[model samples]
Structures are given as C-alpha cells and as structure tokens.
Target: MTATCTWRIWGLEASLTVTDPHRLGEARSIVDTIVADVDRACSRSRPDAELYGRSIRRGRPTRISPALCTLVDAALDAARASDGAVDPTVGRALVSLGRNRHLATESGRPEQAAHADGTLHVGPADHTVIRRHGDMLVVPEGITLDLDATAKAVAADLAADVIADEIGCGVMVDLGGDIAARGETPVGGWQVTIDDGPDEPRTQIALQGDCAVATSSTLHPRWRHRGRSMHHIIDPATGLPAEERWRTVTVVAGRCVDANTVSTACIVKGAAGADWVAATGLPARLVAADRSIIGCNGWPAPDRLAA
Candidate 1:
C-alpha cells in the first residue's frame, strides 16, 4: 500500500506520496530537509540565501555550492529556452511590482488573484546580469535575484528524485502546483487537479511514467498598486505584467522545471502563447479570463479521458 503526507514549508504546501508505507516517515524527513535546504539556497526573501549573497556582486563571480550552481543553471536554461520570457533577471522588476518579499507575511488568501487597473507600463527587459562560470556565479550590484518562478519546481524534481533513489521506492512531490513523480506510480498514474480562480470547477489530468506538470496563473497573487494592476509574471520584453487573454496555463513535461518554465513563459507571451505552446509540442490547457478553454499540442480532449 502507498502512503501520503503533506506539510508546509517555505511558504508553500508540499505533498509527498510514497510507494512503501514503511518508509513514509523517512521519505518525509528527506523531503523536509531538501525543501529547507533549497529555500536557504534559492529564496530571494532570505537575505542570507546564497542567491541573494552572490547576486549583489557587481563585477566578480562568486563560488557557490554544487547544488546551488545546478539550480542557477536550471533557471538560466529556462530563460534561454523561453527567449527571456521566463527571465531570471526580472528580480528588480518583481520587487518594483511588490513581489520582492515573502508572500505569506502580507497575505490574504495564499494564492490571491493578480490583476491591476492602471495603464500597462512598457519598458525594456533587464540586461542579463547573472553569469555563471564553472561553479561560480555573478550578478551586477543592486540587482536582486528572485527565483520564485523555478526554484520550487526544481526543488520538487530534486525531492522526488531523492525519495525514490534513497528510499528505493516510487514517490511524488508537489510543491504548490509544480509536481514531479518517479519510480512506480499509483494505478492509472498520478492524477492532478487544476484550479486557478476564486471559484471555479477543477480539471483533472493524469501523469504516467516519469513525468511532471505545472500551472501558472495571473489570477493568483494579484493586487493593485497606485491604482495599477500587477502580478508576479512579468513580461521581459515590456517589463510589465502580460495582458494575456488566458488567465491560466497548465503544461505537462518530462521534468517539473521544464513544465513550470513553459507555463510561466506562456503567460508572458499572451496572444501568441497558444501557438507557441503548440510549436513546442508540449500538451497544454489554457483558460481565458471568461473561462473559455483552449487545448494545445497534445492536451487531452475534455471529458474524453477520465482522471
């Protein structure tokens, strides 16, 4: 029989499902340790985090831990893959839009809808200040490094790998909406429910084999600043929240990091996102502000496959 556990850490909810009931406790411990380690290393809210420490260096590369280096590389890869739409260099932009701090500290609901009323401000994308050379990294002075977009997803992938390899069993880890599974999956695969609004019927999808899924939405974490609407997902081209027709996008990929990267970038891509998603050949489901749905790539037909 399989066992499942859920806990809160780093201001996100994490769920773990393990194949061996006997190893549940051990698996949870390992996950907890990994989560905390990743938070310390990646979270920009933590002034003591490695990402923050090295991001302040202006001209010189600072040596980082192998694990941190990997995370940084993954983030950069996401930026490159999405043509800067899912930019890691948007830390300054995020902070200016009031997403620089830990969300839990100033929270209403955990995932509040992100919207704004002011004119969309267009600005140039931030220059790439983050550079990695071997195990060292560098960022210009005064540039903040916010890994909010990819760190949790990467952590989920890492935790799932750790649980399956060390515990010698299958496992699934969900950090917020970013999910990853390895080893054996439950019968019919791992079912994932997608919900992205204050009140909306949920949709379910299944993941078979070694797979991951992630959702990015503009309806969550929304707030108005100085009478202007703002959200966390920043368009690198314009340095503003993407005024996309779709409010939410869900994607399935071989890794949680990749899924998250695409989902987020799609939001920034706006009207072109559906075609871009199709071009990438990743199955995706996109929901518009009015709740109309569009399926792209290989997203399952609604109601054809029961979750």
Candidate 2:
C-alpha cells in the first residue's frame, strides 16, 4: 500500500508519497529537513534568510552556504541555458514592481511575484569563483539573486532522492507544481494530472522510472498590482512578466529542477517556446490562453488526453 501526506509551505501546497506505507513518516521528516534548510538559506521573503537583508548588501561579498550557493548556481545555469529567458537577478526588479511590501489588504496573502524593468547587472558568475565546482557562492554587487525559479524544484529533487535512498522505497515529492520521483515505479507508475485551472483543458499521464515533471503557469499564484495582473515567472530580457502566450507549460525531465527550468523558460520564450523546448527533446505540453494544447517531443495528441 502507498502512503501520502500533504501540507502547506511558503504559501504553496507540498505533498509527499511513498510506496511503502510504513516509511511515510520518515519520508516526511526527510522532506521537512530539506525544506527547512532551503527556506533558511534561499527565501527572498525572509528577513533573516542567508540571501536577504545585510547578507546581500552591495559590496558584501558574502560566502553563502553550499545549499544556497548551489541553488543560485542552478538559477544562473538556467539563465544561460535559456538565453536569459529565465534569470535570478529579477529579485530587485520584483521589488521595483511593488513586491517590497506585502500584498494589498484585499489579497490577505503574502506577495509572490510582479513585473520588472529587467535592469539587472547581468554577467557571468565567473567573477564569483566556484572552486572545484563546489557550492561556494558570491553575488556580485548591484545584483540581487532570486531563486524562485529553481529553488523549490531543486529542494523537491533533493528530498525525493534522499527519501527514496534512505527509505528503500519509491517516493514522490511535489512542491507546488514542481514534482520529482525516485526509486522503483509503483503499479501503473506515478499518475499525474495536468490541470492548470478551471478554464484550462486537462489531461492525465503516468511517469515511469526516476523522472520528474513541472508545470509553470501564468495564472496560479498571480496577483493584481495597480489593477494589472502579474505572475511570478519573469522574463529577464524584458524584466516583465512573461507574455501569456501559453497560459501554462509543463515539461518532463530526468530531474525536477531541470524540468522546471525549461518550463519556466518556455513561458518566457512565448511564441517560440514550443520550438525551443522541442529542440531539447523533452516531452512538454503547452496550453494557450485560448485553451488549445501544443505538444512537443512526443506528447500525445490532444484527442488522446482526458477531457
């Protein structure tokens, strides 16, 4: 029998599942520890997080924890891989877009993302010195690192890997929509539903082996700033919310972080997203604002998916 648990974290849903019922609690513990570690180090919202406050001040040249450093590295890697379609320096841009304060009283929830001018000190991380490819990290002056695009997916990967290895069972970790799996595949594999919203078309698919899927959207976790809609995914080239060409994009990859990176980049790539992710050879599903589906790299035809 399988066991599962669900809770809320950082204002998003977090779920864990294991093939062995008895190991469920242990799996949760492993994920909890991983989440806490990441939250402590990478949360841009936390005043005391390693990437916040004085730790990121100009000319600080701080040496961050390996975990946070690695997350930043992954964000930078995604930026390069996506040709700046995904970037970490949008933290300052988000602040400029009115993310410096909590959401307006009507929302009653903490602010998540906003539009930006994309005025980032963009450069190679080469100046920061990554010795031996280690997690050592340094943020350049005039640049504020934002790991919102990668940290959660990386944490899900880490938690799933650890839980499966230590518990000796198949495991799945879903941090919001960034999902990961490891160890054996259960009967019928891990069935996932791609349901972007009430108005969006939906489908179900099964993942096999050690793999992951991520869904990056223009709707979920969105907000209104100055009476205009805004989303979390930032297109660094424009320093603005990605145009809603595809209302949501889902990608399947060997690792959750990689899948999320590509999916988010697709959102930023807009009209060219399908071609870009298709070139990567990973399967993906992109739903347009009009609810039409665009499949790439062997995603089943729209007629084959659940309604």
Overall local distance difference test of candidate 1: 0.78
- Which residue segments of model 1 deviate by more than 4 Å? 54-59, 101-123, 126-128
Candidate 2 per-residue C-alpha lDDT over 1-307 given as tens digits, one digit per residue, 9 for 90 to 100: 6788999998888899899998899899999999999999878677677776464444345666878776777877877778777777776556545564421121211333322643322232221322213543445455556788899999999999998888899998999888999998888888888876676788898889999999999887777766677888776765567788988899999999899989998988889898999999999999888878889898978666533
Best by TM-score: 1
Evaluated at residue 7, the lDDT of candidate 1 is: 78
RMSD of candidate 1 to the truth, in angstroms, is 5.9
For each candidate, the alpha-carbon lDDT, in order, equals 0.78, 0.77
Clashes in candidate 2: how many?
Answer: 1
Question: How much does candidate 1 score in TM-score?
Answer: 0.88
Error of 2 at 261 (Å): 0.8
Across residues 201-303, which tens digit of lDDT does each residue of candidate 1 receive? Answer: 4688878878899999887777876766777788887657788677899999999999999999888888888889889899999888787889887788877
